[model samples]
Target: MVEALTTTIQTASLILAGWCLVSTFRDRPMLVPHLVAVGVLWLLVIAQAVVSAVLMSGGEGPAQTLMFVSYLVFIVLIPPACAVWGFVERSRWGPAVIAFACLILPVMLVRLEQIWNPAGV
Candidate 1:
């Protein structure tokens, strides 16, 4: 995994979470802008996944390969799933759902990093 890319993704996720939380507090439903932001985030995540896959295929893989891959898959799926949920719900809670997902995303990415390169390895 690329450390810089991971950090970028984490930062982006946190920022998006904050934005969604504000939207939730403002009693706003998920809108096109929010969906677009998520779409951008999703693209970033996909880029990271592709890079990781390439590196792994080239034998620069993580020790816990299965776990890493599973996390990777889930991480990739998260944004879109939550986006759909938010879009369909049509309420302030829609942003809340996205906010929750965004918050969880960073933690999951951190775990993915740990799996990719355990400390002192």
Candidate 2:
């Protein structure tokens, strides 16, 4: 895992979590801006996944390949699912849900990095 990409992903997720928190504090439902932010973040995650996959293909990966791929699939899934859940709920808690997911993202990415390069850090 590239440190730069990991930092980028972590930063993006933090920003997204901040946005969600602000919306939740204001008692606002999930809005278009939130969805758009999630979409952009999702794209970044996909890029990260692709890059990591390519690197892993070249054998630059952890021994637990199945576990790493499962994490990949999980991280790829959260944003869209939360977006849908947020939209469906249409309440302050919707943004809270998004905030929760965004919070999970960075931690998950950090774990992914560790799993990818256990000795790097």
Candidate 3:
């Protein structure tokens, strides 16, 4: 993954996580704005996945291609799954769930980056 894209993803994830956290603390359930933010984040993730796949296929990415792909697939599924769960729960915990999921994204992305560029610390 490119450094700039990684930074963007990380920043976005942090922002989303913060939003979710604030919503949860304010006793808000999953709302339209939250869903929209998640949607945008999902699009960003998909774009990154496509770019990474292309890079990998061109022999420009990590040698651990299978692991990278697995992470990509997992990352892509997180937001929607959490969204559904949050919607179903319909409580402050709903936003809490999203908060946790968003928190996971940054860690997952960092792991994906490490898999893609194993040489870096």
Q: Which ten residues in a row have the lowest lDDT in candidate 1?
A: 112-121
Please give each candidate's TM-score: 0.97, 0.95, 0.94
Backbone clash count for every predicted candidate, in the order shown: 0, 0, 0
Give me the overall lDDT of model 3. Answer: 0.86
Model 3, which residues run further than 4 Å from truth? none
Model 2 agreement with the true structure over 1-121: per-residue lDDT tens digits: 6778878878988888998999999999999999999898899889889998998989788888999999999999999999999889898989898889999999999899888878876
Residue pairs whose backbone atoms clash in candidate 3: none
Off by over 4 Å in 2: none
Given candidate 3, what's the lDDT at residue 68? 86
- In model 3, how many backbone clashes occur? 0
Model 1, span 9-82: residue lDDT tens: 98999999999999999999999999999999999999999999999999997889999999999999999999
Cα lDDT computed for each candidate against the true fold = 0.93, 0.89, 0.86
Best by lDDT, which number? Answer: 1
